[model samples]
Each structure stands twice: as C-alpha cells, then as structure tokens.
Target: MLGPLQVRGKDGPLRVPPGRQEVILAALLLEANRVVGTNYLVDLIWEDNPPETARTQVQICVSRLRKLLAGADSTVSISTRPPGYVLHVDTGDVDSLLFTGLVAMARRQRDEGETEKAVALLKSAVALWQGDSLTGLVSGPLANKAHQLDEERLSAVELRMQLELELGRHDRLVGELQLLTHENPLRERLRGQLMCALYWSGRQAEALEAFRTGRRILDQELG
Candidate 1:
C-alpha cells in the first residue's frame, strides 16, 4: 500500500478494492495519524446502522488491510482500545501529513527571515504531492478530507512562492508562478504573485497585463 489510503504501483491511483474492506481503509486514511474510534468507524461505514455482524466484519477488514500493507514499507497498524480501534500510521510516512509539516516549518522559517531555507522546505513539500489527494478513492467524507488537504497543500505553495518573491527571487520563480496563474486563474493571490514576479523581473508590461487579466477573470467569474 502506498499509504493507508493510497495504494501504489497501480496503473493509476490505487483503486479501493470494491467492498467493505475498502470503506474501512478509506475511513482510517481520512483519519490518518489519529485514533479513530471503532464506534465512529462503524457509523461511517454503515451510516449509523450496522449489520448484526458489523463488528466482526470490521475486524476482518482491518486484518486484511494489515496483510495487504505488509509487502510495502508497512507503517500502518491496528490499535485496539477499550472504546474502539485506532489505525495508527506514522505521520512521516503519509505524504499529506509530511507536506503539512514541511509547509508549517517553511512558514516558520520564512517568518524568521530564512528565505533560502524556507524555499528549500517549501519545494520539498510541494514535490511530495503525487496528485490530487485520494484521487481514485470513492467520494464521501474521506474525499472531503482529501480535498481539504489538497487546499492546504496549494496554500503552502502560494505562501512559499510569495516568500521567494519577497526575497527578490522573482526572476527564479517567474516561470512557476506563471504556470500556476494559468492553472489557477481564479486564485487572486496567485495572480497577484504572478504580477509581482513579472514586475520585479523587469516585465512591467506583463505585470500590467496580468493584473488586467485577473480583474477580467474576477469580474466574469464572480459577477
């Protein structure tokens, strides 16, 4: 397993094998690095109503997932407590958590005016993203969590780029910021960064053009 939720070596994002086992694994990943109550897991899988054999089924799923993960650098484990079971996966092994930690560190470094170090940390954080979080996972609470994580990841990228620009690394960042602007046309902050980078790169006309484009986009998209 690439992670608790992300299975690797597949043609694409790992498909959660169709069944209750997949559901259980997905839930654990959504709550990755946290202690998820068994009660909560049951509720999530069965929507507050479980089969007479629900507890047994959950156990089966957990057991199977453990075996599935054994072949890889298995860090995921099932922890049993009085109230419920917790899937304990290390945060460093999970890309999203790693990204979050890196971004947080980068922000702290940036705030401390360690621009070069911040840039390095931020780049590593962004590089951890394989693609959209839980790309092939079934949509539900788990998907929402993935989306939220993705948002945080993107926000970190923007923050890092902003810091780089502030450090007069705009010339180095112009290409990346320009690409991000094209992909995230509705993100005003990204557009602003693109403008800043362009202006500092001695492309005053491009900076003005970017501002106009952003304004037009906001007007058209929001108005």
Candidate 2:
C-alpha cells in the first residue's frame, strides 16, 4: 500500500471506503493472498481499546469491502476462512511486494555487472511509491510498517545514486542530489553523495558548505 489506499477499477481508481473500513481493507491488502486473523485486525484497528463487538465489526467491514471490490468489476476479492480472512489478489497487484521483487532483481543485475539495468529497475521500483507510505492512516503497527517501507525506498535510492556516480554522471546528478538532500536533510549518505556530486563538478566551496550544513543538522537532530 503506497500513499492513500487506492483501488483501481477498469476505468480508474475505485472510490475507497473511508475510516476504519479503509483501515481494515488496507490491512488485508498488506497481507494479500494470506489469511489475516480477525483478532489481529481488531487489535490493529483499535489498538488496546477494542469495543466488545470488534470482531463483528471487522466481519462487517470485510463484507462491505467485498461488495465494493465486486461492484467495481475488480479482480480483488476477500475470502472467509476459519478464524480469519484473505484478500485474494495477484502478487504484482500489491505495490510493496512488487517493489521488493524489483529491488531483488535489481541487485541481481548489479551483481551481473549490468549497472544500467539495475538502475532502470530501481527507477521503476521507486516510481511505485506515489508519496509517503500509508499516508494518513492510523494504527501504530501500520504506521511503523510504513516507516520501514519508506526506509527501504531511501536505501534503493541511495544505491541508485551510488551507481549513477560510478557511471560518471556527476554533473547531471548535482541538481537531483541537491533536491534529495534537501528533502532528507538527516540522511548522511545522501549528504555525502551531494558533496561528492558538487566536488566532482568543480563546486568545492558548495561541497564544503553542504558538509557544514549536514553537520549542523545531524548534531541538532541527534543530540
């Protein structure tokens, strides 16, 4: 699940049901093709303060989601098994799984001495993320999962930038690295890449300035 929980129909994105229903749908989709226990769903949506009828509510939500998906002529479906539910969708339909798969393939390409192919694969992987992972959702575990996904995205970007630098694209990477560093000021690897891009482009003063700025930010943030 990237950005908002968007489910597309044949025409476009199907209108997702809002609030806790959306939360339930998201949780199921996150564990797509696998059984997610009703208990786990309740705990996730309510988190230490579930109502007495939480399980029933979860069942109801799932029923509504099944209807929504079916009515839209969507391929996605929810199945009821003992003690849990399963969202039966293709592996490629889930963005997070596809992202990791691409990243794994990209690593293989890098190992095979095909850096350009690796970078292209990574570009596609990162493109799957529309914005912050799981933006505007509640549930602490899902938020933590989102943070983990965001970190994965950053690592992929870091690897891609490293490969680009090795390919002698320093001059072209300067502006893009500047923007990335600005967006992620606390990321020292990105800061280091920005510095390298600047120095290799004959902007030594700016390179040093970038270091100084990063140092200040790290000290303030870490301390």
lDDT of each: 0.75, 0.91
Model 1 lowest lDDT segment of ten? 1-10
Q: What lDDT does model 1 reach?
A: 0.75
In model 1, residue pairs whose N, Cα or C atoms come closer than 3 Å (at least 3 residues apart or on different chains), thus clashing, are none
Best TM-score goes to which candidate? 2
| Candidate 2 runs further than 4 Å off | none
> How far is 36's C-alpha from truth in model 1 (Å)?
1.0
Q: Per-residue alpha-carbon lDDT of model 1 for 1-223, expressed as tens digits?
A: 2223565422444444666677677677656756677766677677656799888887787777777666454556766665666667767666766777888898898889899999899889888776777655553666667778778877988888888787888888889988988888998899999998999889999999999999999899998
How large is the C-alpha RMSD of every model relative to the true structure?
3.6, 1.0
Worst ten in a row by lDDT for model 2: 1-10
Give candidate 2's whole-model lDDT. Answer: 0.91
What is residue 120's positional error in candidate 1, in angstroms? 0.7
Query: Relative to the unseen true structure, what is the C-alpha lDDT of residue 19 in candidate 2, on a scale of 0 to 100?
Result: 78
